[model samples]
Target: MDAIPFLPLDPLSILLLFVVGFIGGMVSGFIGSGGAFVLTPAMMSLGVPGVVAVASNMAHKFPKALVGAMKRARYGHVDVKLGIVLGIFAEGGVFAGKEIMTRLRAVYGDTGTDLYVSAIFVVVLAVVGGLVLRDALLNRSSRPAGTRQALPAAARWVRSVRIPGTMMRFKSMNNAEVSLLLVAPLGFATGLLAASIAVGGFVGVPAMIYLLGVPAIMATATELVVAFVMGLGGSLFYAWEGFVDIRLAMIILAGSLFGIQIGAIATTYVREQLVKLVMGMIMVVVLFSRLFKMPVYLADLGAVPALSPSLHGALDALSVATLALALLAGAGAILIALARGIAAHRRRHGMLEPAAVD
Candidate 1:
């Protein structure tokens, strides 16, 4: 087999990718949809070819998702059968997405390819992320802290649709028969977005939570199952095309596994709504970071003026800063939440000890 050339192993790049993967993994484990948003772009900035960056990221995603999902399943959050059914559709969508990407590349070359992807990321994140953030904020503002666990309006609407013949019962859906017809379109769209942006769970997890009546905790955990299925199929296709970068995949896997383990265990104690709110905030910020890149791509495709060199530099710096901020904020939130939960657990145990003595 012909070997693909490796990007020269720079210590800085390796360190950066590992750090990026670690934080991204933590976010994915906690929130269920952020590794590739950070990983693929980080690699691309280090001069990995776009497709290779995506392919390697996809390869890493399957195992990480598998581990995370299994861990969350033990916590009683994942709906195995529902995730599988949705995943099968997502898998088929991955093939379709790959074909679209291939055709787009054939026609438009590298610049167009970049433009198309950045645009999709910006648009999807803007709409989806905005809704998520809005809902989170609304929840925080309107409800008392102790009683803020109800589904959002979107979930209520979805449950009320009552589409006949399309309802299927899933243990994760509280044994309710949710509309698979609804799930299919959502899953397929997620797959297409995954093919485009390398992270479909951004859409998939949120959709499950806000639109499909799943709890935020369950939605985030279940997204890993979907990610595993889609990533497995995506990896096979990329491997067939000889695009897998095993070294990068392994490096990312190393850091991500540690992060996933921490995140999985942390979820057992943190408030689920807080996790959802934090994830929602991160999504909105990341959406803008991608949006910042779209103008450059628009210029490349002749849809906008070539930005002034200084202006472009400023935008690039701002985008990087925003992305870094999002990563730090997310990781920090998870760690803090985890620590608080752990401390609370210990305090409760201490209280129980006095009662035992009595």
Candidate 2:
């Protein structure tokens, strides 16, 4: 295997990375998983290789996840037992994912690996994002006040099935009894996607909600535990190959920690429906961002006609802009929701005097 080169980080680059990290962490704290999608592409745009961007992002993820999980756990959101069980199985998937990534890099080089990752991003984000968005829109319009939303039909069906000895009960899941056999596959897929794209929460959170019957807040919080486990293990594997960039990881971590705290707090302020909305919105936007980059990768691999340098540059610029837009849209939504929630809370508490008692 050829040694992967690390890009030099100037002051401006460091500042930009820190900002992106902060936004990514904020989104992760709110939605359970998202920072990686933006961070990976942002790093690539900065000239970091695909593998190193993923490896470094993973290295930073575990610690940030630890902090976010701890914060949410304080609010009684995290399910430690469930997260641990799922994470244990996810480790196996992470190793499997790493193996596939290694082979791709060795055989097809960086461009091939980037192409593969981007393609997966496009498909997963499109399908899942569309479904979640549809659900969010429905909930916004049709849901009754003071009533919890119903689980999806698929989730209800899963909850009904009983697998005798394989059944495991989770207090966090309302003491729901589910088969370990069923849970393990979701964890594996989550880990595999995480290793491949640096954001497994895309699968993990939704699976917890729609399949495992966990609530949205709990699902998001619990995913941090899985992320921590996968990120730690994945980082070790990547670091062994000298692909992990400590400096880059630390810079991102610095901003992400602060963002994570704020994001977690925001979750307490907003409704579950909003969480789905933000996650879906970010996914859809990021999907387009990755789609824009696909042509560049295809041209590089000679799978398509060679793009002129100017056209390639234009496409690359557009891709980066779209990625930034995804982050901004997510952050804007969270901040808006948080602000509204806080104002309502204050009003209920009579924090503002009634017309100054005039």
Candidate 3:
């Protein structure tokens, strides 16, 4: 068997890892879940095995999420009780999802397992992302003036149906009362995705904002809390198995700290409408990237060959290129948003200053 590559602790590798972590952290701070989506692939490209990449990423995520949650709490956006309840359920759900994944692997072997995961990624992103983009765009154009609007149809319906003994009111996020019926399912789905792909926030954040009567800011903030719970649990499990990679985790954490601080600071200056618009665009682009990856996995599983061998090779290359492009685009958008926010803050403060004495 090929020997596993030694832990890459070289200066260049560490620098590259730090940069990746910073970008990923910025994305996560803004969108709720982002570092693992790019960081895992980046680690694999750097010669880390897939499982180790995931374990190290999880280890890094716990502290980062804790820091982020604390920062966003300053903005009064975190729904602490709701996040804790959902996160606890999500913790259990992750184990269930892992059990399912193991069973699937046993039944179908490696190729089939890959195909199943890819299918889930494509389908879930397409449906959930499409809905989120639609809602964000529509809300951006037609939001009511002066006050926050009522929840979405899904949330309204969810709240209306009273499940005996499941109703709960959270003091945070404006004392919103909701049904655990809605939250548990969302939490479960979040856990399932997290276990399967290591980035449940994509699904979880949108679900909270667009389907569970939570504001976007609150949803994003609370997601960090949920991520912290899940990441902590996952890290412990991995550490017990000796898969926790401290060096990799530290490298990513170093960069993420600065990125997260910048992202949090920028949040104070941007209009909510613009945030929604940017989020909508991001969802659409990422959706297409996953869609492109689906066909390759399907072919691997012998489900269907949508392209010839040479064409498939080309498409695989295109998929990787597209993923990189998506990450770059997300990072670029984050930087632009941060810059604009800082400039706006400076201008506002500048306007408040008295004219210089002649």
lDDT of each: 0.79, 0.88, 0.72
Give the winner by TM-score: 2
Between candidates 2 and 3, name the one with more favorable lDDT. Answer: 2
Off by over 4 Å in 3: 1-14, 41-52, 103-114, 144-147, 238-247, 293-313, 355-358
Question: Cα miss at 300, model 1 (Å)?
Answer: 3.9
Between candidates 1 and 2, the TM-score winner: 2
Per model, how many backbone clashes are there? 0, 0, 0
Which stretches of model 1 miss by more than 4 angstroms? 1-6, 151-157, 160-166, 301-303
Sort every candidate by TM-score, greatest first: 2, 1, 3
> Candidate 2: TM-score?
0.96
How many clashing pairs in candidate 2?
Answer: 0
TM-scores for every predicted model = 0.92, 0.96, 0.84
Q: Give the clashing residue pairs of candidate 2, or none.
A: none
Residue-level lDDT of model 2, residues 119-183, one tens digit each, is 99899998888988988899899988779877677777877889889988897768978888888
RMSD of each: 2.6, 2.1, 3.6
